[model samples]
Target: MDYYKVNSKNLSLLKERVSVPTYDRTNVKAGILHIGIGGFHRAHEAFYTDELLNKNSNSNWGICGVALLSFDQRIYQTLKDQNGLYTLIVKELDGTLTKTIIGSIVDYLFAPENPIAVIERIANPEIKIITLTITEGGYNYNEATGEFEIENPSIQKDLKNPNDPKTVFGYLTQGLKLRKENNVSGCTIQSCDNIQGNGHVTKKMLLSYVKHAEPELVSWIESHVSFPNSMVDRITPATVSADMAALKETSGIEDAWPVVCEPFKQWVIEDDFIAGRPAWEKVGAQFVEDVVPYEKMKLSLLNAGHSVLGILGTLIGYSTIDEVVNDTVVSAFLEAYMEQEVIPTLGDLEGVDLNEYKKSLLQRFGNIYIKDQVDRICSESSAKIPKFMLPTVQSQLKDGGSIELAAFVIASWAIYSLGVDENGTKIPIKDAVKAVLHEKAVAAKSNPKAFLDIESIFGSLADSESFVEVFTKSYQNIMQFGVKKCLIDLNSKF
Candidate 1:
């Protein structure tokens, strides 16, 4: 059971079954500085970059990862200890596994350790492209208003002291200012986050923050900086102890922080980089002129499909996505939801076949080896539902299409927020607005319409009598009959 710990010193000790980086990690220069080094980043972006390094002679696209929040301390320490090297375990559908040591990330900076060092690295002329994988909430923008939250306490603190900045906005502003002072050419700011129009949103939020800090820098940023929208997809679950154990047993590499994900990976980016970028397209990435259609497709189907399964599966006592999809009724329901409700919302997509995409989605979700947890998908329903699911609901309502499935999904979420399942097992509610959902969900036990009144979440859909009727009916069905009976009856309808 003795295994070499995953680090620079242990690379030579790795088993032949495991694939180590063929390129020289020591000579790699940090051309891409990535913020928010989460599991998704390690699995998706870093995986692509690793392949690029191995295939081509270009060593300039090495990633220098930054961990901004205090919460990232553990990951930072793990990466630092491993010399920015970690195992990527890809779980195949037939339970086969492929373990590779991802060496794209050569350097790491924990911002909390030294803010100035982080800023200086960003200001480095050699770091041609700065990428971000910060989650949707990390942007610090008002979603409803589409404006930066300037009154935020963190924003206030960052504005007052730009030198010792606390927020991404502050750090970026200071770094860009330093670059300008040093006469360095502007770099590309690419966002690998899941947000729709991520590049445009980043540019807007960053410029808004910078305008308040320094008005003179706005015009310069407009001309120099490039923000490329990207659509990134990978089912990378949180790395648990089991993943580490699996890596140790399968490859004899004792990695402290290994990433586990499904075999499928995708990235569709807008072809716009100011300074330069890696030839990622050589490694299964697509460069398009516009990423909006792809964004809309993925968010509507794949992302919303996760929400559908996550909410319903939790109530039905299913722990993982495969378990949810394996059930005949549940899988049928998902297929019907995509075919009747979701596909209609998306118009003609270039170079995409809707049927094939949906088929692929079903196969991906049912990959038993992945073990994508329902709880991971269920977390942050308050933020996720609005972005991924509700738009479909609104579209269905406008076009007078069937809204029963969408209503059922929302009702399931409302029931889930009640903190207990049908069998009286406590369901842990994980959301930023947990208290609000709990309060509203409790109030809805008596008045079913009360939960819909949160305009921030539901918007004008609450005012529609047809939606209220269907939603209330679905709510009553689940409360009176039970999850399985209600699901069967609902499935029969489609």
Candidate 2:
């Protein structure tokens, strides 16, 4: 099979199989500057922006993507090679593929190649919104202290020499400083990551960086800029070699960096853009006055559900989300956790039917076509649990809701972090605090308090006698009965 390479020239040829951009690519201008051009960004925000461009006469909302670190050089090169054009393969629940050529990305700048271009792009008066999908840990926030870590080596280096910046905070400081100097209007700095109150978090972290670097710019940023909180949801798995081959087989187009995601995607943003914005609502993006409830609901249900399944699934030798979700015991456990444990924490989410959402979440997670990897969900659980699951645990602790399921989830994570499953197979752990987690998990075998003692993740939960009691019992149960037996027992209780 001769597969045509994906580029601007081959869009016409590729359009025979996949939906190509209807908007004039030449006329598309970059109004939005996005950092971290990862799979989730492409599948969610960029997908919505593409729809907006297709429907609206306004073509100024085209995205200009940025790749910050040296490791991101491959994606930078791929996007640049394809002229910022790539294929998005949507895996529908009914075993259908919806392929589209996404051209919303008008430009891509690799920060490592030329940092000046990135700074200048941010300074461009036309660039209104500077969005980010730099993950939860990328914010340079110290979870334990609830403060930005100024002494991070990259931040320190960038602070010492702001001209050649390395960190996002440094780049943002220099760019916003230039914008101020250039008399460019302020724009919205939106975060598309899954953090609760992301906009407020971003504003605080950025201000913390700028205050230490350039105190003069602090007032300008506060008065000129607006940071809008957002709740973004999509199950976008990392693209593998098999996806490329699949694209070649189905669409007959060879894409260097194509993204694959489930059909369902959602973005709820606070309607607080300082500069002019696009009518993304036309393409199904909800603009709300307050995104907190939605964020709470999503993080507590979908995100935490992934963690729960991923930890237990990996422990039970299941490799993908669909595989684990297909198991009746695992599925029932998840349903109980969402209904009994998580839902109570999320007080009223306006215009949302919680039961329907929970049912849809199971369907999304169980989409066999999507093949969302368990390891991907299991990765960085140290960062994910605190943000996604533990909040529910905390809320449940305060309200006297059942924390049993959440406790089991935490215990599963601690056991999984030990780098070995029940069958003695080495479970490859990927976390920033892998060594610490392993050491603590090892220490926790005798003293369960050792694991809870990690003040950053567990916080004050270790002090709660009820939580500690349940958590210790859960940990011991998992060690004795294994994942499947324990899950069956837990589900039977529900």
Candidate 3:
């Protein structure tokens, strides 16, 4: 077995498997049209589809990936290079690693290069479910108001011609309009982003676009489309030269595009597709009537847990989640934050064991092999904080419980927004509020109210006495004593 020939090796492995899965490549048809072709999608959704295809020979769940942004051309070329084949390396905490080739993505289309072709494919009746992982920011909606930003150039163009626009909502609207015109059965639009009530968020953005662009079409879409909420989890890290080298060494396959993720993966989706869906349950996916509790549990706890480590981890100069989890101080902070702050705030969801979930989350975080980056998790904190952390903070405040850790997290954001870590190293702050955050931080150096004025980031919560006191106090503490001293103080106080 000449492993240097990685593609051949993969093909041979695929052939040797007893259940040589085969799809009606001709009649299979595109049942899933996915937006934002990224590493997470490859590790998560594409993996699920591969499993389904393996179980059922006649399954028609082939995916046609549409990359909306121009920079994604590199990814497009990489996937195309390998005939849409790639390996998902799932690294376990206990030094165990497993790799599998995902083959669900049947084709790729760059929207900018061929918008009409992409639109026509989505318009096709064959695409039963239009799934998205376009990131929370991709929707281009104002988080505080939950309304589409009409001022956005993309939104403006999308409004002018719903049939042809650059944005995802525009593409979806245009596709749906074509579907309605062609009398094609309406498809389910599933959002796989980490936003709370993500499906609703996506629906709102799409509907908002339709409202201004085509009012009658909005009604038709409202009646037809099913945007099922989903809670997706996986600690996938960005691929770098190290990852590529590791893949080449292990498999003797020089994969230009390989995805590295933790062994733990989860997909809890609402079973609400119109033209039917795969028995994903067979492939370790959970299909439930209400994904709310599951989503809340995952988002507020697991996802939020990751964010907690993300900010603190970066401040501590740790590169990965595993490093953060292994640090005694970081680990203690997370455990206390989860048990005392996060869990107490969460209302009981039927059939969910909060204790068990928290334990599992800790275990997952401790997985060293995952090598999940703090920076990656910390990206888009402005959007992520509201979904993952603020809800818990809000609930805890309402219940009269102390929110010391939550306050610390918020303060950490304020500190991070200053664009430098404790060591005076430049901390690359990645958020929509990046530009204005520095100015706010400077002004707030004299008065905390200046920081609170960023309504988009803080929402109405910043005005509240409870949040204001804690956030301001913590920010002051960080300024006076620094991150480590503040952490020590928080450990003592809370």
Q: Compared with the true structure, what per-residue lDDT tens digits does model 1 show for residues 142-203?
A: 54567788999999999999888888999999899888888889999999887889999999
Kindly list the per-residue Cα lDDT of model 2 for residues 346-407, writing each as its tens digit: 87777899999999999999999888888899888878989999888888888988999999
Full candidate order by TM-score, most accurate first: 2, 1, 3
Best by lDDT: 2
Question: lDDT (0-100) at residue 449 of candidate 3?
Answer: 62
* Candidate 3 or 2, higher TM-score: 2
* Model 3 ranges with Cα > 4 A deviation: 1-10, 13-28, 161-164
Off by over 4 Å in 2: none
For 323-372, candidate 3 gives per-residue lDDT tens digits of 98888777777778888887776677787788887888888888877777
Residue 2 Cα positional deviation in candidate 2, in Å, after optimal superposition: 4.2
Residue 41, candidate 1: Cα error in Å is: 0.4
What TM-score would candidate 3 get against the native?
A: 0.95
Candidate 1: pairs in clash:
none
RMSD per model, one decimal: 1.5, 1.1, 2.2
Query: Could you tell me the lDDT of residue 141 within candidate 1?
Result: 71
